[model samples]
Target chain A: SQTIHQWPATLVQPVGSPLSLECTVEGTSNPNLYWYRQAAGRGLQLLFYSIGIDQISSEVPQNLSASRPQDRQFILSSKKLLLSDSGFYLCAWRNGGILGDIQYFGAGTRLSVL
Target chain B: AQTVTQSQPEMSVQEAETVTLSCTYDTSESDYYLFWYKQPPSRQMILVIRQEAYKQQNATENRFSVNFQKAAKSFSLKISDSQLGDAAMYFCAYRSTFGNEKLTFGTGTRLTIIP
Candidate 1:
């Protein structure tokens, strides 16, 4: 079984502060990792996705950035956070092959930028 | 570009009743995939069901099933004997068969099961 871990579960950050959210997947190697944000009572917005290490594709232009340091370790970072950056951040992983790939999500990290 | 649409913004059903949530998508590709994800109050996105476009038979998982109409581009979810635990935001998602396809999600429909 594959499991994804994300932390800190919840964070309160002042505006313009640096931010870092980490996601690591165990029991799977070379998986496709994705970063998504969901606004209050709204649908999810894809921020970034990585197929492999050092290969990141950003869907939306924002203050946030994502990196795949290892085969199963992905990190979301920002040099300076904005008020609009506050949302529930989700890290998901899927199989890296041509089979029927279903994404498995982690318990999201809630960031409140005050 | 592929797009997903969930017509109902909110729906309510009594416990043990049945409810159908409508979903339609626009895609140019013949081979693709459609999925329904459930987001509970905890906000964890969980995969509820999935259907491959090339398949003729509708996909079913226990009390959950999908009506996949490839020509109509309609994929609707039917929840039978709805339980209180079924209350959540249901999102319709689409992914293309070609390339590194990313999922395009619909504006979810909030389902409330009245006990």
Candidate 2:
């Protein structure tokens, strides 16, 4: 079985502080990783996705960036956070080799930028 | 680029009744995928059902099923014998077979089940 782990469950960071959130997958390799953000009452928006290590694609111009250091380890980072950077962040992994595999989501982190 | 739309922002349904949520999408591709995801208070996304545009038959999963209209570009979800646990924000998503394979989601419909 494949599972995704993302942490910390909740975060409170002051404005202009650096941020780092990590996500890892177990039981799979060469998986496609994605980062999504959901506002208070809006739908989720795609942030970044990586098909392989060092092959990251940004969906929109944003304050954060994503990196896949390892096949199963992905990190979301920001040099200086802003008040608008606060939201629910989700990490998802998909079986790239499978035909109809669904993206599995993590527990998500509730980021509150103070 | 693909787009998904969920018209109803909020809905309430009585227990054990049937409720259908409407979804429409825009895409130029012939073959693609559609999905319904549920997010509860925990905010974890759960896949309810999925449909392939190439298939003519509708897709069903337990009490959840989808009415897929490929020509009309409409995909609606029907929940039978709704349970209290069904109360959540239901999101309709679309995925392309090509491109980066990212899911394009709609503004979700918040379903409230009346116990």
Candidate 3:
């Protein structure tokens, strides 16, 4: 069975502070990773996705960035956080094989920028 | 570009009753996948059901099932014997069969199960 682990389920930060949220997958290799943000009572917006190490695609211009350091390790980071950056961040992974592209999501992190 | 739409923002059903959440999508591609995800108050996404465009038979999982109308570009989820645990925000999503594993998600419909 595969499992995704996301850290710091909840965080409170001051404006302009740096942000780092980590996501790691177990029991899978070369999986496609994605980052999504959901504002209160709003739909989830795709932020970034990585196909492989050092390969990242930005869906929309924003303050956040994502990285795939290893086959199963993905990280979402920001040099400086904005008040608008506060929301629920989710990490998802899909297998690279020919199997159905069903994405598995992590627990998610709720960030509040004060 | 593909887009998903969940027309209902919120719906309510009495416990042990049945409810249907509507979802429709637009896509030029013929082969693709549609999914229904549930996000409870805890805010963790849980996959409820999935439907493939090529499959004619609707997919069902226990009490959850999807009505996939390819020509209508509609995929609606029906929950039978609804329970309080079924209360959550349900999202409809779409993904192409090839290239770009990114999922296009709808705004979501909040389901409330009354006791």
Number of the top DockQ candidate: 2
List where candidate 2 sits over 4 angstroms from the true fold. none
Interface RMSD of each: 1.4, 1.1, 1.2
TM-score against native, each model: 0.97, 0.98, 0.97
> DockQ of candidate 1?
0.67
State which docking tier applies to candidate 1.
Answer: medium
Residues A1-114 of candidate 3 have per-residue lDDT tens digits of 899999889999999999999999999889988999999998888899988899999998998888888889999999999999999999998887665678989999999999
State the local distance difference test value for candidate 3: 0.92
The 10 consecutive residues of candidate 1 chain A with the worst lDDT sum are A95-104
Which residue ranges in model 3 land beyond 4 Å of their true spot? none
User: In model 1, what lDDT does residue A42 have?
Assistant: 77
How much is the lDDT of residue B61 in candidate 3?
100
On residues A1-114, what C-alpha lDDT tens digit does candidate 1 reach at each position?
889999999999999999999999999889999999989877788899999999999999999999998999999999999999999999999999765689889999999999
Could you tell me how far off, in angstroms, the CA of residue B102 lies in candidate 2 after the best superposition? 1.2
| Residue pairs that clash (backbone atoms under 3 angstroms), model 3 | none
Ranked candidates, highest DockQ first = 2, 3, 1
Deviation (Å) of B81 in candidate 2: 0.6
